[model samples]
Target: MRQAYSYVRLSSKKQIQGYGQERQWEAIQMSALAHGWDLSDKTFSDLGVSGWKGANIETGALSQFLKCVEDGYVEKGSVLIVENVDRLSRAGVNRAVTLLMQLLDSGISIFTFTDNKLYEPNSPNPLMDLMGWALSAQRAFEESERKSQMILNAKAKAREEARTSGKIITRRCPSWMQVNANKTVFELLPERVDTVRKIFALYINGYGTPRIGRLLTEEGRKPLVGRAWYPRSLSRILQYRAVLGEYQPTLNGKAEGEPIKDYYPAIITEDQFNEAQAILHEGGAGQGRRGEDMRNYYAGLLRCSCGEGMHIVSSKVKGKRYYQMRCLQYRISCFGGSWNFNKFASFTLFALRRLPLLELMGSRDNGNIKQLNDKVIQLSSRLEDSRKQLENTINAIAELGLNELLQNKYKQLTSLIAETDSQLHAAKSALELSHGQVAIQKEDTQMLTGRLLELLANTKDVDSRIKLNQVLRRYLSKIELEADKTNELRYIRIYRKDGDLLVTAECSHRLNNALFYGSDGTTEAMELVRE
Candidate 1:
């Protein structure tokens, strides 16, 4: 007996949960019985996959059926049954026709059960068959296109309402929040809020995403979405400005309009959020997995005067272990002199402990901050003007029909809007850093300095060393080392995040000591430079 296989598709979760699949299967069975074909229990299903976008063909079970047909696993005389031609595809007329022809050319008879239509392998009325397929494809495409536009329109209306009324528009919100019964307000999930706050606290305390994830998992804390905490998810949570009660409207996955501040209940303070952003900007957080031991305390911040990273190398000679810091390009250039890692680390720690924290935090250029704020405002106005011009051009084109001048103007406005939007984003990021610097200056520097001194004293373990390195990066930008022509004296420069010089020192490898140099051409021995 000839064999028949059923194909079913439902484009949404709601459709999948309804009687769509069962109805299709029932029709397929009835058709197979009527034709005396053996209906195979193994059926292909693409549930909750979009046919309009060809997702069903790309990653769904329909792809597997195509593979089977191409490999000759399904016999030439076998039957392929679907509820309607749309179940096979709604990807538009050209693609739909191509798919229909491919299946028919494979010698598989397609039976669409909706109209009891059998598209035979070699139809006598080929033109009629083609017309029928084309019409069905066109209908499906039009319906899907109309539905998509309706959805876009509805979302635009909701966004407008949200902007004017400050009401929650959609059920989709942060994991820690939910829309109220009338969808006019958002309510926080207390448990998830606690988790979010904990994540930010852990990140500010110098724990990387992977480490934070592991810590949460070990403590048996349940994630809002998944069974276990993931590093990427934790990192995203730490970066979300939503915790600060801000909502950035997006269109087609890109930020669209101005951000709405104070849109949700703030989970963390602006200070805490700014601090976290500062750490992220310095590339301190989200360092993937680490080894059992951190070999260098100055992992990313240390570099040679030749603009190359100072990589660490370790070796064991007989019973003694030695560590050396060398330029990454030393073998090729030989310009960056090597230093004993232990002595260099000690000297750096000593100088950092005595540095004034308040001065470092307040070193940012107020002029630069003001310039960025002005740039943000100017770009925002330009973007609004360009968008309005684009909208007006679109209206003109609709009224007067397409012309060379209008088309050019539309393209120009589109390009201008994109460029201005990009500039606006960059300016906002710089402004965020300025705000973070201000927050840092407002902090209790005396207490912070005391904490720093304590942390600097406790770097014996790998975890402590890693934590201290990340913490120092929040304030200090980079440390550069150079050597005199003799290669005996190593000169080190410590720079704050604002690019201001914090300290300059010279180290003598022979004496295993360093001397701090003041800007007034005075030198103080390391022992005399007190905290």
Candidate 2:
């Protein structure tokens, strides 16, 4: 009996519970059992990994497997069972082909269930073995491409439907809404409908989204059967058009949906909604800090003894435009206040020295900046779309004379604009900040891979804590201060990059990564190609 290795893959969660991998495993095991392959050997498997991203076959996994074969871990000419060829690769198609050749050269036999084809290295016809794999892979490529196109087509259809019908076809909605049994249309939760009405009424009475949100929170407005109101939920309530009693105007010949009243119960009359919208569009009164949610690149990340976000707020501190941040919390209790940018930056520079190696997070490849251009374009477009939608809603409310609602919504929209602008400015400013990072990443990776790679290329010493700090702070986590002292010390909380706001929870993505590597984990690292 020959020892055999089995490989199987399922792309998503549904497939896992649906027995996709189980069926594949069973078929391969049955084949091995019937053929009398060695039953005593251990099984090798990668389960519930994607066929879309790197085929779960790249990223050192496949490399280790090939090394195993070369080391004679399995019998020569032994069978490798797979659910199908694509399980081996839906990515790196060319690499998969070359690897197949290598396996054949090593006298390995391949067996698959989808086509019931078998590869026998001893077979007289090399074409039979080669053609079976080549054709199956070709089919996989075609199918994947087809699915990609179909997804695009579906999204396009959704957008088209939205534009033509004056309806934003929601992919998701608030918890207080229930989808019809068919699961396409949505209706208000009867238990929570009054809360929705109150939200609209508050909004219609010149309360901004955030304030209205707070009122709901104070009221303990839990999702019908769930907990507190999420920001998204309050946001939705303030945005719903049914409160205005009409639909948005047809733009570019796309408006074709049933009018606003057809969707949900109206909370505010159209006229009231319009009046509210007008006040909002005109910017009646100031409320909330400008750009409160969007942290400045340096301000929030930098620290002072007080622990409040160091406010780099320009003020006439002896009549000069200066950037600074201070612990707002310290103002009343400890005379905590903002700091000048120059002093704060200098203090932070020393902190940077603690990191033995720093790499800017991104592709370190020469083409990375070019790759980032595409992302910039995509984010820009989405941001613009969001702005436009906000505008349309504001205008719709104004037209209906909902001044109070308009005022409230305008505040939210204004805040969103300010926040977005802040982030855009930070990204632009940090473009330079990332320079040292990119250089460090390149240096580290060069050691890892460039001719006779040194594994721990970035480490300066056994206890080089700051080296990890540089890369981790920028590329891995968004940070927040947890505690601060009058002295120059601070405690912090962290979240994933572009992840959520500063969470107080002790657990974090960074802590988990540490546990993964433990103490003995190899320190060799790859550099990002930020060129």
Candidate 3:
């Protein structure tokens, strides 16, 4: 008996009211049964995929079908079953005909259920090929053009309405704002209003886009929709006038097209938004290049008190190499100046040495640990299930021979299995790291202190120093330096990695003599303070 593979497809989302996948499959089933062809279980269905995209495109089910054919999965003399010729493709008259001819040339016979016709490899039928295939292509092209005209007409109506009644159509709402009951006007999402305010505050406080993204992520603050904050996404928020209740048609998230007032509720005041824009306009100093061998160890770590990043600038004088950390916006919007590389490095080391090493390796509660463990187990189970499904699908496809129609499911299963495996591996790694943390309680502090002091002294090599710095960064978020009122003393303010100020100290220029300001209603917590 000849092997038969069923191919079914829906052109676009507009076809929902038209013939459905079930109807197409039903027709193929009846036709295959009547022809005595052995139908396979796997049926290729490209739902919501545009036929105009064609087989050369990377996406859609048809692309995967062609890939299977190229990989020598579909054998010659196999019967290809479809509800209709248009179900195979609506790429164009010439392209569709050429593709069908190629399949026929390969010894495959195409049986169209709708027409109850058989297209053979050698037989030429101009009437069926030209009239049937060509008409489908022409109809597809006309439908596509009609849809484009409809969109243009809708956009024109929306534009006219916005001009007259101040109401514009939007596809999606902004994170900080929501639509009203009628979906005609925008309103503030109360919970997200504070988030939008905080973003502006961060920008005004001197944190650049990249730094703000990191700060939000570390603080466990998610965006209005997505998992993590993006710098460009933040930049758009910074520049968006919608926070001031203005309607702006954005092109690529930038203000370009048109503007209307009072389209959205004001989440942030106009003055505040204007000030934030001014601060953002004064762009951070771009990191050019330092030296060939010398690298800035604190490139991403160092921040200026003026809310700008300190980049490394290298200079060679009298054959001696020198590096200095200068604020990107120094002498302009930033009053905080530059520092010598040695002085910056030494100050950072001094601050790091004074850190509580035991507390830095803080342990999570039993509940948190259990949650991580459970996550790993859950992901591993899912990974295993996906792998089994993939294996079963592959075996079924191989048993009936390589059917191009079935390969779309194979590709999807393979991708799903891979994604699950990756997620599982990441979960396991996080579980192991959580378990590995050496939490030193108050009783064990003395022992840990001695070991830490010993390690600090012995860490002389560049590699050892780098590792020690990395560990310090986990506990110490930033080190902001500024001169005191008298300009006789420099202050080194230490912050936690979560952007919280932990300790502030007045120190000598070299950070040799240090006195920390305490918050326990006293001026001294010289020992160690931890959460």
Candidate 4:
């Protein structure tokens, strides 16, 4: 018997997760071996890549082997085994034909393990059978596309209905707005609304983005959407011209290219929104680097030395100098090179600083790192205890019958689980709590660490500036760098309080001098300071 290679593939998601691929591979290999074929030197390969995808497979050893056959690599009498016809290709029309014929004309005998059919070049009905397989592949492709389009259309229709009816549509809402039982307009917090109202008032009073964000966060105000009170959200509320109630449909989350439709109850007027913008950009103090941007650097390229922010600070050749664009999140600036924007423009140059960032862009801690072994032991003991208690409770219930027993045995079981969890937490804490010890939960820690290292190693298309961000997230928080020259980013600080995992940007003047803005002219701006 001629030597042959076995090919295994999954054509559809249904089949991909099923036993079909494994079964097919087993059947073909077994049959070939049974027929007195010497298979010890041969390779059994699987093209795990989805067949419908048109990209050439370089990494797929099995798939590449098939291609090699088509390229006159193997003898015509050599066997090419596939589990099923669909496993060959779901790519439609000409592309599908080109691939199928490549395998066929290579003179390799085609064998389908499932149907037990063999196709030889000398077969009279070869053309008819190939056509049948090709037609089936085309149907699967058409069906997949049709399903995708239907889902998208449904989503669009649902959004439209939600906008018109004034009822919130998505289960996913921002942090502040509480979903009501009836699913009505979001329940805006009365206290937070006052903060929102005051933000507008501050903008009217000539305050810019920095002061506004600081004031709100200092007052413990949060955005209507997300949990944290982000500066970007403040900008959104300020830019919304309809806050004064002029009623433009664009004020809502309408897409730009999309035809604007009348939607939402407009609270502010367009004039109010525009006035806020004017306040943000006008006057000697209000001169933005080039329209009040939220970003402090060129697409997050710079960090404040003070760990606040380093915006293009401008100051007039004046007596009392003030800084702008410094973060107010921190008590003080770390970068410390605060200047007013008006005078700084001459030095900073015409800053187009256009955003390439158009609104772009998880761990369960079981055992304690310091105390993993202790935690595991403690948890095991606790679990054992819970089991005993549960057994006693169950037996008592049987003896006492329904009326005399505990009201909810299930609830008691839940408490037992909680108790076990607490014991585990304590044990883990104790083990890892020692100063000079490796992590107790080493397995989970290693997994997370490995993933982070993978992210750092990928240098393709991304450079050092991007690397800084990856580094900041991995080792530090509130990463601040200062610019001494045209593009020298120095004076780095990571805001990592000891044993605290939360990493937030510290918004001191020294820190924010070279940082960018996060407001959209709808909010107030703060003066940058040099500390």
Task: Please identify which of the two predictions, 1 or 2, would achieve the higher TM-score against the true structure.
Answer: 1
The TM-score obtained by model 1 is: 0.74
Q: For each candidate in turn, give its C-alpha RMSD to the true structure in angstroms.
A: 6.3, 25.9, 23.6, 27.2
Candidate 3 has what TM-score? 0.50
Estimate the overall C-alpha local distance difference test score of candidate 4: 0.49
The worst-scoring run of ten residues by lDDT in candidate 3 lies at: 285-294
- Candidate 2 stretches with Cα past 4 Å from truth are 11-22, 39-54, 58-78, 90-95, 98-109, 113-128, 147-174, 182-185, 200-215, 223-531
Write down the TM-score for model 4: 0.36
Look at candidate 1 and give me any clashing residue pairs. none
Stretches of candidate 4 off by over 4 Å are 1-91, 105-125, 156-160, 163-169, 173-531
TM-score of each: 0.74, 0.41, 0.50, 0.36
For model 2, what is the alpha-carbon lDDT of residue 307?
46
Q: Tell me, by TM-score, which candidate is best.
A: 1
Best-first order by TM-score:
1, 3, 2, 4
Clashes of 3: 1
Q: For candidate 2, what is the TM-score? A: 0.41
lDDT of 1: 0.81
Alpha carbon deviation, residue 457, candidate 3 (Å): 39
Predicted model with the maximum lDDT: 1
